[model samples]
Target: MHPHSPPWRKSPLRVWLSSGISSLFELLNAANELFSRPRNLSSPRTPR
Candidate 1:
């Protein structure tokens, strides 16, 4: 294997693990955003 070539690219297990981890991070981020703020639905927008 060439030193510059990515070893993970050739492995199915590594790819699945990496995608799972990435999806977990995305889920965490979405949960954080959902829990962090209260949306203001009553506020009127001012036209500029």
Candidate 2:
């Protein structure tokens, strides 16, 4: 592999790493929404 190769075509490992990182970020965003929103809706005391 040439050092000057284009970034996307670097190697299978690099491609997989980039994709994994993106998916991890997406998962984190989803987790943040889930935790942040429910605090108001699902409180410790039940609404009657």
Candidate 3:
């Protein structure tokens, strides 16, 4: 087997893993945004 074949074999796996990670991060970001808004709304940040 040639050296180039190893890289080709792993490229699909790398792409799959990276796409999954990106999707997970997006979900986490959305969840954080959703959960953070209510806390800010419920808490009054005005200094008495």
Candidate 4:
């Protein structure tokens, strides 16, 4: 085989990377939402 690779061979890796990145972004978004909205109990950011 030659040193170079074909497009079909790279598709699986590219797809996997894309999916992993999307999942990471989703997790970050969930964390951001939770931080943005505190629990029902008292919080330092919210005054009495």
Candidate 5:
């Protein structure tokens, strides 16, 4: 049941890769949100 072997021995690899990719996307999206919007720490930095 080696990962680099035949497809029949890749079930764990498949699940691992899919979950890793999904979490990677979630992290990226969260970072994008953090930078793309301004948070109201104390005063709103909106335009005057």
Candidate 6:
């Protein structure tokens, strides 16, 4: 068997953990943008 074989690699748990962390950050950022501002058509910037 070779030293750099599949058996020497880390398990799937590590991959899942890293993916979850990154996804969580993306979700939080999207939520922050969604809640931090209000969309209004009656504002001065609106077109008549």
**Best candidate, lDDT-wise?**
2
Model 2 per-residue lDDT tens digits across residues 1-48: 546877667788898999999999999999999998788677855584
The lDDT of model 6 is 0.74
For all candidates in order, the CA lDDT equals: 0.74, 0.86, 0.84, 0.82, 0.77, 0.74
lDDT of 1 by residue, 1-48 (tens): 557667777788898999999999999999887765434322344332
RMSD (Å) per prediction: 7.7, 4.5, 4.5, 4.9, 5.8, 5.3
For model 5, residues 1-48, the per-residue Cα lDDT tens digits are: 645777745688888989999999999999988766656532466565
Better of 1 and 5 by TM-score: 5
Better of 2 and 3 by lDDT: 2
Give lDDT tens digits, candidate 6, residues 1-48: 546657425868778888999999999999887766545434556775
lDDT of 2: 0.86
Instruction: List the candidate 4 regions with Cα displacement exceeding 4 Å.
Output: 1-11, 39-47
Best to worst by TM-score, what's the order? 2, 3, 6, 4, 5, 1
Worst 10 residues of 2 by lDDT: 39-48
Candidate with better lDDT, 5 vs 6: 5
Cα RMSD, model 3: 4.5
Q: For residues 1-48, write the lDDT of model 4, one tens digit per residue.
A: 678787867788888988999999999999988876676444765786
- Against the true structure, candidate 6 reaches a TM-score of 0.58
Evaluate model 3: give its TM-score: 0.59
Give every collision pair in model 3.
none
